[model samples]
Each structure stands twice: as C-alpha cells, then as structure tokens.
Target: METPVRSARRESAPLRSTLVAIGLTIFGLLGAAIATLPAVLVDPMLAKGVAAASIEGQTLYMILNFVGMALAGAIYLAATGRGWSYVDFRLPSTTGWIYVLVGMGASIAFLFVVNIVVQLLSLPAAESEVVAIVGQDQTMILIMIGIVVFFNAPAEEFLFRNVVQKRLYEAFTRMQSVLLASTIFALVHFPMYVALADSIAATLTSLAIMFGGAIIFGTLYVKTRNLVVPIAAHAALNAFQFGVLYLAIEYNVEGVGTSPSAIVGILPSLPP
Candidate 1:
C-alpha cells in the first residue's frame, strides 16, 4: 500500500509542476498589463494639453510605468515564496562582462538583419505608441534617452527575464522556457503597434522582430545566470538607439528613416 501511494504521487508530480508554471505565467502577464494602465490613462490628458506633451510629462509617464512594473514583480515574488533570492543580481565577473559585450553586439547585429528583412519583405515600418507622443513633442526624445537606460531596460528585464523566464524553467526545457517567455514579451507589446503599423502584416513583422530580440536577451540571462548581463545589454541597446534618433533629429537628417517610428521596431524593450 505504501509503494502504491508513493508511485501515485510520483506520477502526478510532472502534471502538478506544469499547472503551477502555467498559473504563474498567467499571473506575470496580467501583472505586466496592469502595470501599464497608469501610463495609458495619462495619455488622454497629454493629448488634451491638460498635461503638456513635454519632457516632464513623458518622464512622469515612464516613471509611473516603471514603478508599477517593479511593484508588480515584487508582489509576484513574494506571493511565490521566492522573494529576491530567486534572482541573481550580483555584479558580473570578468567573463560575465565579456558576455555583456557579446549580448550588446549580437543585439545590434540582430537589428541590422531585421532592418534588411523588413526592407526585403516590403513591409511598411511599424511605429510604437511612444512615437506618436514624440511626434507631438520633440522634447520627449530628450527624456527618452535619459530614462531608457536607467528605467526602461531594467524594468522589462527584471520582470520578463528574472520573473517570467526564470519561473518557466522549472517545468520546461531551457529553450522552451526562453521561447515561451519571449512570446509573452512580444504579445504584451502587440496592442501598442497594432494601430500604428501600416498594415497587419507590418504589425506582425514588428512583433516577430520583438520576439527575436527578447530571445537574445533571454538567452544571455540563461547563459550568464546573472540578470545584470541582460539588463546591461538591454540598457546599452536602448541608449544607442535613442541616441541615434536624437542625433538625426538634431542634424535634420532626412530620407534615411532615422525617426522613432522607423527604428522602433528594430529593437525590443522600448518603453511602453
């Protein structure tokens, strides 16, 4: 009787683990969505000029979004009994730095491929929700560069990589976990691009690019076992991208598609 009972528990373990993983994944996704609500709510005021569409307003918006996500992630951790111990935030060693550099380079290289593929497919460029705000107030670009590194990058990686991807590892293979997490990352951004994209095809392509970029970030986190690697890499990429947009706008460069809308789809993890 004891042997039969033990075998029955063993048979149910995998199923139980899988269900738990699925439940947690849904919770993480919902948390991310809810986290964006405050920022989304402010958009109406910005448009009406009740809050000026300036750098200050945009910065507040970003801060709200970042803070919301961070709080949600903290709650998720606490609920799971993992808390902060589950995440690896120690400073990267020399080898970890090498991986950081590799991640940045690989992400950039990946962008180049994405740009070419977009052109080859003749798909129209996809714009993000942020691009609309930038179009209204150019000063928003200034704020973007300031916060993207310190806020946007860390917020996304901490939630998606550290919380979501790490949680998935318990029930899935390394590759499967990465892919699933990346897919969720991409899906969460879909609403931002849907109306802004030139066509459904363009929107889908943009999400695909986002998914791929997330995969790169996820892989870096998995390989290094350090969240900082992905966070740093994500920060550097956003900084480089927004920097280029600022330069192009300042120099009045044209016909090169350097605007926020043109390049936003090339990378993932931009502000929501």
Candidate 2:
C-alpha cells in the first residue's frame, strides 16, 4: 500500500540521482578548467617565468588541475551533506590487488590491440597536445611520468569513479553505472582531441579508445568497491607507457610516432 506521496518520491529518486550525476560530471570538467586558471593567468605574471607549455609549466597545470577537481568534489560532497566518508576509501584486499594487476594488464593489452586495429583500418588516432612538447625530451617525459602517477591518475579516478560513477549507482544498475560513467569520462575528454585529431574519424577513434580505458577503470572500481584499485591501475598503466616513451626517445626507436599519446590518453591528458 504505497501512498501517493511515497510513490512520487520513489519516482523522483532516480531522476534526482540522474541530475546529480550529470551535474557532477559537468563539474568534473569545469573544475579542471577553472582550477588550472592560475597556470593560464597568474602563473605567467609571477617571477617563476614558467611558460605554460614547458615541463614545469605543464606540471604546475596538472597540480592545479587536481586542486581544482578536489575543490569541486569537496563542494559537491558538502552540498549533498555527504563527506569523504561517502566514498569507499578502504585499502584493497589481496584479491583487490589481483584485480588491480589484472586491470593494468587488460588495459595495456587493449591499447595494443587498438593500435593494430587502427593501423589495419588506416584510421588516424590523435595524440594529446602535450605529446608535441614532451615528444623526445627524456627529461620532460620523465617529469610527465611523475605527474601522471601522482596527480593525473588520482584526480581522474576521484572525479569519475569515486564521484560520478558512485552517484549513478543510486539510479542505475551497477554495470549501467559503469557504462554511463565511462561515457561521461569519454565525453569530458572529447574536446581535448578536437583541434588536434585531424579528422572526425581520428577524434572518434581517440574517444573510443579512451572510452574503453574508462570502462576498464570503471569496471575495476565496481568490481573491487575500492578507489585504490582503479587509481593504481591507471597510474601504473600511464607510468609504463611513459616509461616506454622514455626508452623510445633514448634509443631513437622508429615507428614510435605520436601514437603513444593516443594509447595513454586514457590519462585523458589535459589540453595544452
């Protein structure tokens, strides 16, 4: 015997959860954009003289991006009367650690397969703008490796997995939540490739690859119910890719074109 008021509330719950998820997704992107403003504006005026594209400049940008996302996440939690307690912050169990390793292996294997498919089809996969600056500079690549490990991976996992995906769980099935969150993750990253992707095909290919990476990340988060798993997998995959980049640059390996950016753009590397 459901009362009318109770029925209305039940009907609205999913809608409310949906709207909240959308809002948080937008905020995740907006936070990164807004948080990096200091790098875009004030940092240039300071005595540091860090060019926005230099390794130091990019590192600063990433750090500020994380700060912005953290602020945005905090604001959301506060508005909802939720807090850090709302997220599953527990350490991974031994089983969770196994999932983490599996996630990394799966993601790497996915990227390798994607490269082969793209080449077979002759589709151009766009690289991140950062690729140009960090291309062959072992020093810069090393710095970026550190940035991805510490700042980039955690910030993205915090926003997409801990925040966005978690919110959607209230309204959707767990797999649906993972899927929707992965889509949002890909969409948020779509703009970074538009100007540089060369064509719609290339841009879409890049987005699809990133979408797959997010799926891997989201699936693992749902599977383990722990943020640390996805964060570790994401950070490890990026670190490995960058490490490879370092070796390629150091050894002058051929055929290592800008594609590595596409492979690791799951970091969804921020725009320049």
Clashes of each: 0, 1
Model 1 per-residue lDDT tens digits across residues 58-140: 56666655656656777878987998898789999999999999999998888778777766766665665555556534466
Clashing pairs in 1: none
Off by over 4 Å in 1: 1-44, 47-52, 136-138, 255-272
Candidate 2 residue-wise lDDT, 1-272, digit = tens = 98999999988987887778778877866887687777766456322422236666667777787767767877898888888898777889999999999999999899889888988888787765556646667787888778778887888888888888898888789999988888877877677778567788878988888889999999999899999999999999988887777777788877664773344563343653
In candidate 2 the C-alpha lDDT for residue 14 amounts to 76
Which residue runs does candidate 2 get wrong by more than 4 Å? 1-15, 41-52, 260-262, 266-269
Any idea what lDDT model 2 has? Answer: 0.77
- On a 0 to 1 TM-score scale, where does candidate 2 land against the true structure? 0.89
Which candidate achieves the best lDDT against the true structure?
Answer: 2
Q: Look at candidate 2 and give me any clashing residue pairs.
A: 265-268
